[model samples]
Target: MIDYGSEIAITGDDPMMDFRADPDLIEFIEKLGRARNHYLSLTRGDFTLLYENEGMAVYTRSYKNETAFIALNNTSEKQEILIPTDKLGSKKQLIGLVNNDLIKEQNGNYPLSINGEESEIYIVRDNHGLKMLNVIVIIAIPIVFLILYFYIWKRGKNNG
Candidate 1:
């Protein structure tokens, strides 16, 4: 966790790391969390307002076409924050938590939101093998029935 009132440097290839704490950053984080509905359990205690000269680093992650918010306090004090996880667009990774918690390289809980507003989102990963199995089963049923139908029809015709 970053101190509530300190300068934090985010070095990465992420385009959102603008290194500015203006109202826009705060609004962007809030809006992203709301739109994505990633955190449905977020509450008022989750966020704390930064006074002038106080700022924090808001980290975001994208995975499996979902977004996650990780609010880090760079200030000198621990602040309650209400970070919006929905506005992250198609990213996945929870804020304030490491990536090893939720899914592989995923962190934090679901239904996280800003200021107690539920971000109606739930995260889940799909196994391709299961999907393929279901498809094969569904297709095989009809194919087998067709083959049996032809075999019986030919046998009856020859016997007659």
Candidate 2:
């Protein structure tokens, strides 16, 4: 219900509502809420079915050059599937934004095993988060120096 900006309404009628009394359930809900609210692409993104089979299906939601890869296992048993990624632009890794799972593309495909009926969402991107941080620092240094230089120049001009 999050995709396309649909409101997710939870009432007392849900089958899982019985767990409302459990702290574990509340914790899980909190985590899910964080996952849903923290990611803008998950709420408003272009949806595409990447792969599908009788036992499982894989899809993606993308926005602003970012994409979330979602996988669902429909059967009660563990199912393994290879998601072809040759067509997904330059994405080489899928880091779980909430699940803490890390997946790397292999031979232009991603192999995943889902346990029972479960769903996983991964942010499709290169494992360059740390690199990006370094890049940010690198880019900021010159800009900061330029700003300081201009400020000092202006102050010196006013004083003179």
Candidate 3:
């Protein structure tokens, strides 16, 4: 958890920004979500973020107004994240999920809002087709089994 008033000097595109957890907010941040990568975008500056493996990079566009942007990626296929509401600044906003399809659901508990919009957004990964298979199993497998059982039982009655 980042403290509400912690003064964090965000500069350049340091990898540390990926999980920019404030020391003062550590206790609070720990309770919310695991710090992955975090960074702030200044409207008038240029920066680059390089991943440890160099496979991922984040480029920023500086504007005259103060705009803060954060990108979170759950390299793992299954992950759960918590966002601490108290640590977020008033001006902090989520630019990506505002009106897009990535948003799965929203809750009122967390201050997970962007650009003055207060709402929680749930993000679901495609899971490389495995997730789809899982869903099919849950719904289709049972129906298929029941149909096969009925078909075999009816055929035996007719034969007898």
Candidate 4:
């Protein structure tokens, strides 16, 4: 079967149609479609190489308002890459778009791990803000209320 269009046509160039396609081909195509969808929405900008060592390369796609970090493990083995503080800007965490993995900043380094021949896109964000907010709400507010109550009680007793 051939698929035709007007300009910049595909011309049925997909060779997999000529032979016995693998049973998993459908699922694989679905996965590829999902990745393509994500790329269209999240990765539309100038790409900058962030880190490269041995068999892995990390990059960030920037478009004024949005930025996405992508790490690729080209080799057939697992890779662990340590991203330094300079490349991280002020972001403290990487939230995965595909695998939903969360990589946190530890001691100024972001630890990245990827499986053999895999890639991941991440959204950078800060983890410290919520922590400080928790401390203020759970710890600081109660302490201030307790001090005020104690002062009023002491003043009332003295007057009585």
Highest-scoring model, lDDT: 2
Full-model lDDT for every candidate = 0.43, 0.75, 0.38, 0.74
lDDT of 4 by residue, 69-157 (tens): 88989999999888887887655688887678898887778889999998887877666656767877899888999999999999999
After superposition, the stretches of candidate 2 with alpha carbons farther than 4 Å from their true spots are 1-20, 129-160
lDDT score, candidate 2, position 158? 100
Q: Supply candidate 2's per-residue lDDT for 4.
A: 25
Q: What TM-score does structure 3 among the candidates reach?
A: 0.22
All candidates in order of lDDT, best leading = 2, 4, 1, 3
lDDT of 1 at 31: 55
Query: What is the model-wide C-alpha lDDT for candidate 1?
Result: 0.43
lDDT of 1 by residue, 18-131 (tens): 566666545545555564454443321233232222454444444544434454444555544433334432234333332223322223223332222122222323322347
Where does candidate 1 stray beyond 4 Å?
1-130
Instruction: Give, for candidate 4, the lowest lDDT window spanning 10 residues.
Output: 1-10
Q: Model 2: which residue pairs collide?
A: none
Candidate 3 weakest lDDT stretch, 10 residues: 50-59
Quote model 4's TM-score: 0.58
Candidate 2 C-alpha lDDT tens digits along 82-110? 77777565457887755678887777778
**What is the TM-score of each predicted model, taking all chains together?**
0.24, 0.64, 0.22, 0.58
Q: Alpha-carbon error at 54 in model 2, in Å?
A: 1.9
